[model samples]
Target chain A: MKFSARNVFRGKVKSLKKGPVNSEVTIEMPGGLEMVATVTTQSAENMGLAEGAETTALIKATQVMLVSE
Target chain B: MKFSARNVFRGKVKSLKKGPVNSEVTIEMPGGLEMVATVTTQSAENMGLAEGAETTALIKATQVMLVSE
Candidate 1:
């Protein structure tokens, strides 16, 4: 399943916050901005994603539909 | 930016193939097993995805790892 999203940023996994059914993964960009993504523990392990690991964050800018204050 | 894939199948956009940089979205599954995605016709009219609408195909199945002939 290859999705065609723009490779917004490539960064290193800065932290992994555990959650009930999912985990919050934060990637630290070169410019210092952070992008947070949510993935299942299963996915995290399967992707071998962990703090300090290199990864790219693909984002369908449009899918980012909204943001709330 | 949210990415917590695993929605697997919930299709409708039955065809829209036109590629160069990217564009090859085909989603049609109802136990029928057909999942192919590759978007960008400006993301098919900014997610106004044609051909019957109703979208949902988030797959992180180990990134579909690999495939060969």
Candidate 2:
């Protein structure tokens, strides 16, 4: 599916940490890059996310911040 | 400054497109990976973003989504 998010990394679910309100998901992408995402617990369950699952991490351009250093 | 965002990429500004409310900033990072970010025009101006400027793109874990494909 095509979306507006500019950053999309295809990866495998490396870990899952479920919390009351939010769940932390870590995806292991190519080149050893890991992307972490936090989603609502409800959404996490709805998606049936589990470790070793293949998923794509999406990040909207607007959500990205430019930090000058 | 240290931030909570899990994804931090250092790159040079390759291009900038300004709109009424937002500006599209394209950063070219190592390995030829290009990341695009949309920021408020005000913030873009405040940051003085331009071509060839070095900046770090930050994306929080909460702002990311995982999609199964």
Which residue ranges in model 1 land beyond 4 Å of their true spot? A1-3, A66-69, B1-4, B7-24, B27-32, B36-38, B42-69
lDDT of 1 by residue, B4-49 (tens): 4655567788887776556777888897677878777766665667
Give the native contact fraction of candidate 1. Answer: 0.21
Residue A36 CA error for candidate 2 (Å)?
Answer: 1.2
TM-score of each: 0.56, 0.85
Residue A19, candidate 1: C-alpha displacement in angstroms: 2.3
Candidate 2 local lDDT, B1-69, one digit each (tens): 788898888889999999999999999877676789999999999999999999999989989988885
CA error at residue A46 for candidate 2, angstroms: 2.8
Residue A57 lDDT in candidate 2: 90
DockQ of each: 0.18, 0.71
- Candidate 2 error regions (>4 Å): none
